[model samples]
Target: MKKVLVTGASGQLGKCFQKIASEYPEMELRNFNSSELDITDQNRLQQIFSEENPEYCINCAAYTNVEKAEDDEETAFKINAEAVKNLAEVCKNTGTVLIHISTDYVFDGKATNAYRETDVVNPINVYGASKLKGEEYIRQILDQHFIFRTSWLYSEFGHNFFNTILKKAEEGATLNITTSQTGTPTNANDLADFILQLIREENSEFGLYHYSNLGEATWYDFAKAILEFSGKIDQVTLNKSGYYKTRAERPTYSVLDKQKLQETFKKLVLHWRDSLEDLIINRFRKI
Candidate 1:
């Protein structure tokens, strides 16, 4: 079996990997939550690497509080950038292929079309800048790394937009989602599946890639779909507010170009609506 390690196994995307790990029985997975393996603690990381000796290390630990990151810049950089540097250094020494997750926020949201891997990045917020720094560190330190920049990720687990909408609808609450921002709503499960499949195929066409569900929508469009899919459209009041107040500046349009991923893997990218509907009907609703 191919031994693999997952950091930040408690988060939404990490949990998605854990949930589907059993399906890929050829891989032996070692999952570690933040408490178990702090990416910032290089000593602990070294010890874990020595003990596990995993052929692949998927680094999912990150500081994802976009609004709070504005004021807490130090903490965000510590976890997102410095900690990533530590991981990259360790992976380089251990000869472990590192698969790191990044954000589409690296772009300043000024692009008229979808963002390609070669697009010049100009992060407008602290969170985006920190993630970009981490990506840079990985590129400089490790030659065998996969940096996947994804946008508007959501899933059945954790405190994401998808779950928040479901909770509000259950309580019969009114929601004023914004139509100002445009991006793709990526299902975390589909991303996890793609990564595992990449490892399975032993695909070496790695460097940096943009991965997200096909098509794009505004936050309002996403919220409406969530309600519609769950059969709760009429249970709650959903409004189309042109803008929402926020401390951080977000990209107005962050749709990623998936031509590279599609052409490389020769796999189909599911549309956001279809993936959202599948997760709700096949997984979330059952829970």
Candidate 2:
């Protein structure tokens, strides 16, 4: 069995990996939450790398708060950049292939067309800048690495747009989501499945790639889709707003192109609406 180590096991995407780990019997996954594995602590990371000696190390640990990152730049950089540097170093020494999750926020969101992996990066926020720094560190430190830059990720677990909308609808709260930004609403579970596919196939054609659901949508579109898919459209009033006030400025448009991912992996990428519908109908049927 191929052994894999995952960091930030408590986060949404990390939890996605945990939820689907059992399906892949040929792979053995060892998960570590923040408390269990302090990625910022280099000595602890080295020790764990030495002990586990995993063939793959998936770094899901990141400072993802966009607004809060504006005020807490140091903390964001520490976790997103410095800690990632440490992980890359340890992975390099241990001969472990690093699978890192990055953000589409790395782009300035000005491109009228979908962003290619070769596009120039110009991050607009602290969170994006820090994540870009982490990506740079990985590229510099290790060659056997896969950096997947995805957009608008949400899952069944954790505080995300999908859960927020569902909870608000359950409480009969009127929602006014923004239409300012345009990007794909990627299901974290879909991303998790794709990562496992790479590991299972032992994919060697790895470097930088953009991965997201096939189609793109704005926050307003995403909210509407979630409500409609969950059969909660009549439960609450959903309005489209041109603006949503926030501390950190987001991209006006940040849709990522998945042409490289499709051609490289030769895997069918599901549309965002289909994925969301499936999650609502099958996965969240109990709710």
Candidate 3:
């Protein structure tokens, strides 16, 4: 069986991988939380790579706090950029393929059309710049890499936009979520499934890819969907993001073009609303 190593194993995306890993029997999967394996530490990564020699490494570890990253760029860069460089070095030496997760923030959010892999990147925030740096390291350091740039991922396994909205609904609170920023809300489970498909098929058509639920919506639209799904529409009044202040400068539009990934994988995609409904009603049952 092929061995796969998952870094940031305790995070939401990593846990999503763990939740469905059992159904596959052709691969032996091992995950490590930040406590067990800090990606920033090159020595620890070297030791792990020397021992496991994983055939595939899924890097789920990242500093994702968009606003918090503004105040602490050092920690963000360490985890998102320098750490990625270290991991890429090990993966290159060990002959392990790296699957690194990235974000839509790589684009400055001023585009009128969906962003393709070839689109020029201009990160306006620290988180975005840092993630872009990680991608650069992978490209420069390792050729065997698949960099997935996804947007607004949510799952039942961890803290995310969906959960936050659900909590607000439960408390009968009105929310003024951002209507200014627009992007797809991806289901983490769907993303995990796609990753496994790549592994199962051993697909080699690799580089940068965009995989997000089809259709675009602002944060306000997202909030409304969550409230509607939970039958709590009466509890919240969604408003434009301009009413609410955020520390980081978010892109006004950052939806990604999935044509490359869809055509390559020969896979059907889900709409943001459909995936959101499934998660709320089905509680993230495998889909």
TM-score of each: 0.98, 0.98, 0.96
Candidate 2 lDDT (Cα, 0 to 1)? 0.95
Residue 129 local lDDT, model 3: 99
* Candidate 3 TM-score to native: 0.96
State how far residue 113 of model 2 sits from its true place (Å): 0.2
Q: How well is each residue in 111-132 modelled by candidate 2, as lDDT tens digits?
A: 9999999999999999999999
Which run of 10 residues does model 3 get worst, by summed lDDT?
A: 236-245
Q: Any residue pairs clashing in model 3, and if so which?
A: 178-241, 179-241
Taken over the whole model, the C-alpha lDDT of each candidate is 0.96, 0.95, 0.92
Return model 2's CA RMSD, one decimal: 1.0
Alpha-carbon shift of residue 196 in model 2 (angstroms): 0.6
Best by lDDT: 1
**What TM-score number comes out for model 1?**
0.98
Would you list the clashing residue pairs of candidate 2? none
Taking every candidate in turn, the Cα RMSD to the unseen true structure, in Å, is 1.0, 1.0, 2.0
RMSD of 3: 2.0
Q: Candidate 1 clashing pairs? A: none
lDDT tens readout by residue for model 3, 41-119? 9999999999998999999999999999999999999999999999999999999999999999999999999999999
